[model samples]
Target chain A: MTDGLPMRVTATGLPARVRIHEVGARDGLQNEKSVVPTEVKAEFIHRLAGAGLTTVEATSFVHPKWVPQLADAEALFPMLRDLGGEAHLPVLVPNARGLDRALALGARRIAVFGSATETFANRNLNRTVDESLAMFEPVVARARQDEVHVRGYLSMCFGDPWEGAVPVSQVVRVAKALVELGCDELSLGDTIGVATPGHVLALLTALNEAGVPTSAIGVHFHDTYGQALSNTLAALQHGVTTVDASAGGLGGCPYAKSATGNLATEDLVWMLDGLGIETGVDLGRLTATSAWMAERLGRPSPSRTVRALSHKES
Target chain B: MTDGLPMRVTATGLPARVRIHEVGARDGLQNEKSVVPTEVKAEFIHRLAGAGLTTVEATSFVHPKWVPQLADAEALFPMLRDLGGEAHLPVLVPNARGLDRALALGARRIAVFGSATETFANRNLNRTVDESLAMFEPVVARARQDEVHVRGYLSMCFGDPWEGAVPVSQVVRVAKALVELGCDELSLGDTIGVATPGHVLALLTALNEAGVPTSAIGVHFHDTYGQALSNTLAALQHGVTTVDASAGGLGGCPYAKSATGNLATEDLVWMLDGLGIETGVDLGRLTATSAWMAERLGRPSPSRTVRALSHKES
Candidate 1:
């Protein structure tokens, strides 16, 4: 133990650090058929943060009539403070009422949803695409007055199931609008799971040409067509830094019928780790958490990395 | 009809072509439970060509103890000519003896297997790395003298199951060796299917750095980890145009325990057609072919694209 070889154990860690925003508590629950207990959701966030996630989206304060699964958002966010303050838990707010509920729950960081395609906006939010943006303007302004950091979501960025393909111009328009509304960052969502690497390159390149900084862009991809990680790498190649991943691969847009699952956080971290990108996560722990949640959901963990590593390895 | 409308009608009238390379007769049959009858193999290839695969691989001519499934290679390849030359059948030849059998069967083209890693070479070919390559040199020379085109195969381009990670140096070394050995084209196989888009880029870049031309490198991927199509896109990005796909997702490497299936040709063609890549394939007909093969295999086809379009759309 006293030899120089033993003394020279410290090595420089991973080169580039990729920040993972865990969306399980919110995005995962949004698609659940079972009415998840609010206590379970709060406990889920606690376990996620304890497992080393810095940012976990806590809940969405939407109307109870529509998404009954997360209708108890009012009680969830306040209970998060009792859990701990180490993790920054964000809530999804749609309008002033939703924002008021989030603020009442003592939410500091929050996210709002927007759609690029007009057809999707009309079908989902009962408004045109521009009307949806206009609605979020005051919500962003109100959040700014409260000094809350807001993340804006631009869904149907890749393709809409109903509308077929959403144009990149629509994506650029929606993204620029969200940024102008004083949102801290914009996350693009491929609502339908029909995206490939080529579509990712074209969309991200168009966004870059539209003057949106890559650092301010976050990617929320579904592994439905099995191209999420590839799209993530394409965005990374175009300089996108922040990525959103669902823990245990628990993800599906509420409006999407076959919205299989999001990019697994475990797989993304695995790829990034192999590429020398430091994702400040314990993969072994993360895989365990995902497995536990999947068991709770009565389904196998959808993350291929989790299955491979957990089954065939230490 | 107006002149413009007539032009559109004519475009629709012309049959949509698809280069259906039937790997099942070789790639699929190589991993079956029972040794198929040689006439059954011919009938399968005939049915496949009738279903519209112009190119099909009939049998493998390896030593009997090595690959007992294709021990009837001498009987199988010759019987394929009785399919009335409807299918352009190619056979696998491990050495000159196999080549002699193939030439006796009048094989115009032959596929030679190589490995990008020494570990795979030992497992797959039963020889030390260079010894395997040295083994193929005279075999290729003999094919050249007979004016037979050799399609070289490099397995485990991304990784090998025995060895955790394959060095890019090994991939370039083997690819360059095959091309230099007079193989007309190369199809790099993701043997264990752990490849991601980044790994594909790294391997392709290494091949390019080693002065291997992109036009000759076709990707042969397995959907084991659900990364095949994304990896295919990475190859296309770097100008490696050709890709190898199995119909009805009929093949998985027997040595790879976790591999789900090969990349489905119908699915790949859907993405390629969407991206406007001229793969000379018909999507609808390919779906029918996949279904017919799936019925014969007594299993559900492994293509989601076909299932979705057929059940949902039709």
Candidate 2:
């Protein structure tokens, strides 16, 4: 239970309520070394939504050749259709083909992936930034026509493994293009987790100046460099309401060797709970869900909240 | 290298410079599972100073029966006496006996420990809060008479394991007593690592209002709940300049089973480096020193910055 202290430190500019876009079932399991069973994935999603997460990234509708881990997306999405009627079950769509497959499965929400740096775009997507944007243009247009909600993921927004620190202007350019092309929301991602709070402020300011409103933005940070929570806090102070996190600390950057995973949803909830920021998520249930998943993964969850909560329970 | 953008967002009230009091050699190794050899401990301290940390907490002079890991304090203090001329090598002295032990070796800087919760003080030090404060009175007084600098550590300032959430008024009372007893600096410690940024702001505000100058206050946080850096950021934004961090994220909490060690120096340096706030800590060298220590500990350094930097080098 939170003490219900003064929630908004008005001078600090932190938000009153934060939207946590849970990415465990999609972005998290997709990076696992082993393929999670379709039933296990569905159960994981069910448990997440049961924990009061309003938005859970369900699966990726990508080509199986590219990501074998998420090859069960077609099966996964259909099985999760009955859970959490109001929950946003956004699936990652690489192109028009992926979008079509997601639509075929009756997915109402989908996401397109883009990258800020040319090197990451070329290597990860086998296309230049312009080519990648071109590929997503048709998918976004069709999604808009279908009256489906679409989220755009801009990766390498902070730094590229090969190109080093990316300029704020470059991230802004990609973010603007995604929004212009018809994304309902854009999730700026630090794929390598080299971001700090100041960098988050700089990039967000640049994006805001470029005319992409902060209301349409969410932050996705990896915990690879342990800057994710601080970066998320900065985004909150910057008035960005939505944040992307994974349950049980489930994913790692496939691009950055030895990198950790996304910011843990439980850890994020701990901070939000302490700040008295409304997230509509149950910390106890979330911790239990992560603990269950961690037992299945045969390792301890890296989420500090999950670890602490589980220890308390034990 | 920082991009050198506007370092201080004037409205945020963050300090232009932060003083990092390195606590790895003392707080860190004291909780280590294995006893570090005296020469290795000296090298660790030397390497920390070489990494540009000007205030490395060297060792503790507590009774060996209480903290057997720091039994070699006499040998360690003399060994590191000539390493860094400008660095303040502060040692932790529990009472007059420990103070006499440290003073015998010409220790110039020493710290006295106190607790905000009566339960922790009684359990950890075998004295109630008032009794502990009474015990430290003569010690702090004698240290002041010797013209040696003294720091007071107020543990459980936010929460205690036995007592759920510590009253802010209780923490302020203990803090005021320590300052009135002639402590040169007071380090407010989140012993259980349960503090969030909001809690940090509330506690700091209460302390400031109770006549403890923000300038004389330092924050010591553990990453048990992964809230250390975020809490530290909040403290910075609230105008506190001094922070305590451990190298390689060494030292698990002997009390809190699930708690990690102190906030890692490398991680703190990474954030400061990005914020363009001056800490004078060499990120690369700090990472290297942690890596070296982690080798001796038979594990990889838990500091995310250390892991990321070492991976980059490899």
Candidate 3:
């Protein structure tokens, strides 16, 4: 309870350590209506790395026209060169061109986004599911050739806003394809946040059956329906170690003003810390960093843990 | 995805059906800074029952001096008499006087609140833990004599704000004392919202080893740190059937302006519905009810489900 920490009480059948794939700099800020200054984004990532987050997603290399909020990806990536830690800066590469741009700047880790369902694939990437996979094929191959750590982000793994229930087999097929295409890890995303614990376990079970090891899989859950933490717990129960969360739950849902987007990193840390799972992240520093970011965002943080901890400090 | 419903996918070894103990009318509003009118309170309860919640805690019969927000309990109980349904209206009775008042109003069910830690017991009840338990003994005895159902609410069962990391043994001692005093059910409360899934499972396991059956246990979790739903999932995994929640997350925390209170009913329903567990509650109707209450409270609901579903409607 001192410094807003939960008492450690380890559970059976869970990984001892979880690597938090901090997505605040990329996934979080991308959804912001206003563009954050490139320096601020760099400082945010630096703060995240300083708080002990090893893998901090820097920014997306998608076209500036599509995501103006992260238009300074070229400028922002260079500022993080002095982050000075064992932190891995992973940037999202949309295609071969994006990958080329990321590689020119010495990016060591890259992630390719794909959709599990055709409807989402068409909506998000403006291509069919197969077409999106085809696009990622060359990019992933190129990244693997250069010894880059490639993470395949499969969106709408459980339920789609348009397609409703996504078949587990469909997700497995794409996930297997991503791994086959030389991706080192796959991050399963509940895009609309419509998944439950059973669905989470079912999907993970299906992926394992399809030859994907638990160690190579991560989970990206949104808190749109407040299922993120519970779903994360279910994922942990299934031996998945990497969890994607936004610092201060930075990505607010674009569809609704009140709807939450990504799962808050602080909230995830609270659960992990309480369960005796180490994420190497400092809770107090992370909360302070998120609070600082929220102030910059001109809004209060959507993270319950951040708010609770910051309120205590105040 | 129509009407904002999650696709059903069942998890193994979970209860086929869960009975939701709706506490919005009592525990939720009791923490409100301003008192809601008696008519509005009665209407809210009716709406909740209409939405298929079987057990709705109506109000607390504690002295008005302590809880002025629910002081209209005397005026509210009679208004619910005309509520035609299978719904059970339970009320909190602080002492013998409160029990007499509820019994006179023909209350069929009553709950006595006790604190597991001596600090909380002394602060909340103005007596030692043993002394508070002794006070509840007569009230529980009297209620049982009248063939009334009794629920013992053990607050700060997980962690206390003043005394951090409450021991599992200490909670078990108070819980056993409550059962020995003739309580029919025990609601273990995470009053400070500091519990993780492992802590939840550990406590449940310890309670079971101490002779408290899962059948007689319920979980009441607060969302101060966003662990309520995850903790509830852990409790459900341990075979707990009754889960407590507040409609629209009605109880905002008194300690912090940004701190959330109860596990939101909408959020819980979203998880249970997706798990394919029968709760007999309509998600659409329940969301509408909570939204209506939130309007009356003049604040947006803290429930992620409520916001997501209500946003879809707008």
Candidate 4:
């Protein structure tokens, strides 16, 4: 209660420790209306690492025209070079050209975003699902040959805005394809945030049956319907070790102002900390870092933990 | 994706149906800054019942000086008389005087609010925990003699603002006392919203071990830290079938504007609907009701499902 921490009470059938893949810098910022300066973005990543997040997503190497918010990825990546010793800085690469730019800058880990649904794949990447997967094949192969770790992000794994509920078989096929692409890990994304516990477990079970081990899986849930933490709990119960969350619940849907985006890192930490699952992050410090970023964004944080803790501090 | 419904995938070991105790009119409106008109309050309760909420808490018979928001409880209670056939309109009775006021108005069901922590008992009721329990003893005795259903609410069961991490034994003792007071049901409240899934399960398990059946208990979770749904899921897994929620996530902490209040009914429905659990409520209709209430309150609803679904409707 002193630092807004929950009482630690471990649950059964959960992972002993979870690796938090912090995505506030890249995934969180990409959807922002205003572009953040390069220096501030670097500082945000550093603060996240300082708060004990071992894996901090840095920036995207996509064309600036597509995502102007992260156009300073080249300049920002250098400022984060010192943090390599403290955390894993993974940048997003869209294709072979993006991978070339990232490798030129000595990026050691990278992620390629794919979609489980054709509608989302076509809308987000301007290609069919198979076409997008084919495009990522070469990028993933080159990254593997360079000995760089590759994380494949499968978006819209649960429901699509245009396509309704995506079939589990469709998701399993796409997930297996990503695994076969030599990716070190696959992060299943509930892009529209409509997933629930049973659906989450069903998807994980299907992916496992399709030869994708739970150890190779991660979960990225949006809190759009306030189901992110519950879904995360389901995935953790299924033996998932990696969980992706944004610091301070940073992202908002570009189309819907009231719609929330990724699950807040502080909220996730509260649950993990209460479950007595080690994530190595200092919650108080992480909350402070989020408060600082919220100030720069000139808006209040969407995270309930961040709001509650910062309100207490004030 | 249509109407913001999640994919229905039934989870194992969960109850087939959950009865939501809608508290927007009583618990939610009590915390608002401005008092809503009595007619609007009546319409809100009627709309909740129309949306298939079988148990809608109407209003509190507490001293108006303490909660001026519900000062027109006498007027509001009469307007809800016609809803008796559609829903259980349980009013809150603080003491013998409140019980008298409610019974005179033909109320058939009532609830008495207590606290698991001594500090909250002293501050809220201006008496020791035992003193408050003694006060409710006669009121509950009279109600039971009159054949009126009674519910006892035990607040701060998980964590307290003044006393952190309340002992499970302490909550169990208080809960048992309430049940012994002839109350038909007991609601365990996470007053500060600091509870997590493990703590939730632990408390439920302890209460059962203390001879309190899961069917006789309900969970009232605040979304102050965004743990409500996950905590509710844990309770459901423990076989708890009753959940307390506010329409449109009403009620903000009076002391902290940014802190959320009770768990939103829409958010709860989204999860239950996705889990293939029956709640007998029409989600689309329920969301519309919340949106209407938010307009009356002059603010956006805090419920993620309401926001997501209403945004699409517009």
Candidate 5:
């Protein structure tokens, strides 16, 4: 296995091994109208880790008023921690208060999210762009002091629902700020899933030129427009080693009315396996996990891989 | 606009423009369990042409005993000819009898189907690989003599359900025979939707090295495992300008149990538009057309673009 180098490019021009940052428990469940029980959420994470995901975003520390679906984060985090696996359970922290709650629960890694566009920042984070960055600054600083790894998420990096197509320079400036503020990794998110491979290549190339190492870059894509896999390929070709995916293709953007599911972990794993890239994930286990979760959700998984495999199995 | 010259490669290593050969009416509806009315089928072609699709495959001349869905090809072809748009209505011709029926209906363009793998050739065409090629020889020669354009379809070029992962050399041999037999173009079919981008690049590279022009290669992909668009991107990067897509993501291989819909035309058009590639299809009308057809079929369109646009409009 290759070390977690910032820019590990293989002979085939892709990462030798990719870290799939599982967000199904956090991002995927948060978007659902039906609130999942805390126990079910914990089991989903356990199953995901059992499927070989090293990094699992367990829960978010947002206020219940904002995200009632994840209101059981406090109850869920300790259960996930008690499972005692090698997986990194990262929690989403909106500000210092959320970080403090996560710290009290012994979260070793936490993520802070900001928006690339002002409208999204105001709507999602309830603050101006400067205010949102200011909000995360102390949380990131405190996490660094406590030896906690911080991952930063920049949403709408390609296009915004209100602001339309975002400039690459705008994304680069905010990404640089997050790195300077002690974020160990930054995820460029297509929140509305409007990105194509050309936009992905252009943005990642510009970010590299602006001094953000590709190794510290992860891509979080939604499959609303069916471009996630193609966009992920572009990211890998540019030497980005971390990718964010949701099991059973869970999650949808609340701001973008037309957006659908996140890039399915099973679909991503299938492509990586086909390309002969190492992901340390078992496709059969992942497929079974998604199928199990899909039954709990009382609906079929939107992932083509999950559907194809499930249909084949049945 | 670039000429349809064989082997045209732009500086960006992509074709300047792609010719979308719409296969909705024939290959798409042919697999449906419910028979589409001839009038609705006629309207679908009219709407597709109005949306600026230059080459639309109308219906197949295969005997209704084999494909009852396209039983009205005789009635359908005459109606399509009376509509009289710039679209080329290429009907599938199974053999000399099918070709004779198409000729009697004044069909100017037709496509013959073959198989790359031996088992698939025997199972689908009821002949061995050599026997299948021999069966198409006289049909292609006669079509060429009548000044009618002919396209050849090579199924299981990437993978066969019966005999897994067909070799690239086998596909090249079959493709070369079609071209030598006066087929104007060859559409390589991933009948099982198991192809990844790496396989696509390798196969296309082998074919080009084998003296087949890139311009004459069209990719027909299924979205079963969500690899169609990614494969299409790889094909375009290799300078292949022709793509086969189905409106509303219609079509499945009745022989292959797991294969799903063909790559949706609207989805392909969205990516092409985003990449700044010129495809003369109108996105709005195409969405409307798919939505209208979906209503007639009593289901929502399987196309992500059509769904997204319809959702946004509603």
Candidate 6:
């Protein structure tokens, strides 16, 4: 509705409208110890969609064994068939089998991931970056044949838990491969949250130099180092439009061993508003959703902004 | 000696030493829900000084009726008498009465606070900004008479909780007044953690224009908005050297009525190291201090960097 223009109102006059992809229902819930009922996830997705999110990562179509927490995704997807909102509910599909499962559940949107570091790739997918890319090619092709829009995730773009600092070229190599393979958008994820603003800018500059369009790039950062939003600001300065965040700061990356949880959606929106970037998110609604999710999980949110602001209003 | 530099690593190539001030034993404990035993706080302060902090804020001398949390100041100061191991113990003194109490207890160093914003001045001390300065002048005058090295605190320099946005002129006006009052060093506090790098730069610029020496300025920031380290970077870029941080990010402003805790000393040290500033402190020891403090308080640290880095090593 804002004409896809970056210009925002009355804050800083920089172009606004940063697209936010709420990954709470899937990415947030996938690492929980308790089994969240399928109906609850379905309702969460509906509520998120209603809260003005243009992209809600609905659920991952991976096997029940690998992610026992998301075992309900199979039933949840089919039960929540009515899309009353306009956002894309893209599901994660690791390979041809996962893509088949998602398609069987009538999924029209899917995302594939390849780690930028060989260590992280093998650690997560039991394959190297090239091998993971090879595996994802056919999945992307199949999703395309079904007229599904494919997104790509490039993990460990900042640092790998096993191999240490991931070089910008490694990130570019995987991101370029994903972009060239017809993935519509590629998200660079700081899985361990160690990326400084300098690292973010350097990697983005490398990708920009390699001729990847900035428009096709998204950022997924963790607040482990308290640099997520600052890094986001740098990304925005470099023309990155899409960002992935979890409600209530849910979902720690168990793969990183003991890293901080994903960046909080409410916190991200709070910063974006201050910077005059529109996320089309209702702050009050987001806070409500996060509070609901926090209570369901029996945990306090990892979001300081949410906690601070909520207490002030009361 | 780190050449008395704010963040410079080598004092003109003489090898910089980073100075850490342990505020947790005092500021951190003062705001906690549980009143730690006098022995516990004394032990904590002793341990902190042993861990190599050159300056430790021993305790505050505010009215016992105002902050019952530190009412044990009567019992606490006597134990720390000649107890500092290679460190200077400074106590927070609010008024002439508080100064007299500290002087009675052999407190040789004291910190006095004056707010830039009228709203904060009223809320914190039930006085106007000028009225607050009037109160500070007599304390500084008395400290001079007692040969006390007075480090003045100018609260709400960047922003205020009740006042919303504070102008840089307002801050400079107060800072100039504090300097004129014979404060040896002035620490500007972002009381509610509402400062951005831009805000820091604006205030510093105005202070510089007002003939305030950067060498005489220190920064005290809260992490409520996750901008403390970044603002610290801006400070370094502007040549303001002294910094005040709580041991575990424990020093929340009681006046702000928010959990706007002080910048974690460990995290501050981490950033300073990355920026090549020589702060003579062991990161591991600082982390241990915060972690230990958190466990004692029955809570996790308010420091993102400390939590992330500590977990990574574990």
Top candidate on TM-score is 4
Q: Per-residue lDDT for B1-314 in model 1, tens only?
A: 01110001111111232244557668866786776667776767766666555677778888878778788887776666666456567778999898887887788888899887777778778897699889999999899899887889888776666666677787888889888989987888887667765667677777888888777677888765556676676667666766788876677777654555787776676566545555555566777766765666677776655554454444
Per-residue C-alpha lDDT of model 3 across residues B249-298, encoded as one tens digit per residue: 87854532333579999999999999999999988899999999999989
Instruction: List lDDT for all candidates, in order.
Output: 0.74, 0.86, 0.89, 0.90, 0.86, 0.76
Q: Which candidate leads the pack in lDDT?
A: 4
Off by over 4 Å in 4: A1-4, A252-259, B1-4, B252-259
TM-score for each of the candidates = 0.84, 0.96, 0.97, 0.98, 0.95, 0.85
Comparison by TM-score, 3 against 5, better one: 3
User: What tens-digit string does per-residue lDDT give for candidate 4 at A1-314?
Assistant: 24344888999999999999999999899898878888899889999999999999999999999999999988999999898789999999999999999999999999999999987788789999999999999999999999999999998898887778888999999999999999999999988899999999999998888889999999999999899998998888889999999999988545323346699999999989989999999999999999999999999999999998888779
* DockQ for each model: 0.15, 0.46, 0.67, 0.66, 0.33, 0.18
Residue B94, model 5: lDDT of 93
- How would you encode candidate 4's per-residue C-alpha lDDT over B1-314 as one tens digit per residue? 25345889999989999999999988889998888999899999989999999999999999999999989999889888788788999999999999999999999999999999898888889889999999999999999999999999998898877777888999999999999999899999988888999999999999889999999999999888889998998889889999999999987444323336799999999999999999999998899999999999999999988888888778
lDDT of 5 by residue, A1-314 (tens): 11110111122576778999999999988988998888899889998999888999999998888899988988999898655557999999998889889999999999999999999888898898888889999999999999999999999888776777788789999999999989999999998777877788888888889888898999999887778887798788778889999988988877666557799998888778777788888888988999999899999999998898888778
lDDT string for model 3 (A162-238, tens) is 66778889899999999999999999988788899998999899889889999999999999989999999999999
**Candidate 6 docking DockQ:** 0.18
Q: Model 6 chain B, TM?
A: 0.90
Candidate 2 stretches with Cα past 4 Å from truth are A1-12, B1-12
**Model 3 bad stretches (over 4 Å):** A1-4, A252-259, B1-4, B252-259
Of candidate 6 chain A, the 10-residue stretch with the lowest lDDT total is A1-10
TM-score of chain B of 3: 0.97
- Better structure of 2 and 6 per DockQ: 2
- What's the residue-level lDDT of A268 in candidate 4? 94
**By TM-score: ranked, best first:** 4, 3, 2, 5, 6, 1
- Position B21, candidate 3: lDDT: 99
Instruction: Assess candidate 5 and give its lDDT.
Output: 0.86
Worst 10 residues of 3 chain B by lDDT: B252-261
The sequence of per-residue lDDT tens digits that candidate 1 reaches over residues A44-150 is 78878877888899888888888888998877777778644587888899898999988887899889999988877887899998898889999999999999999
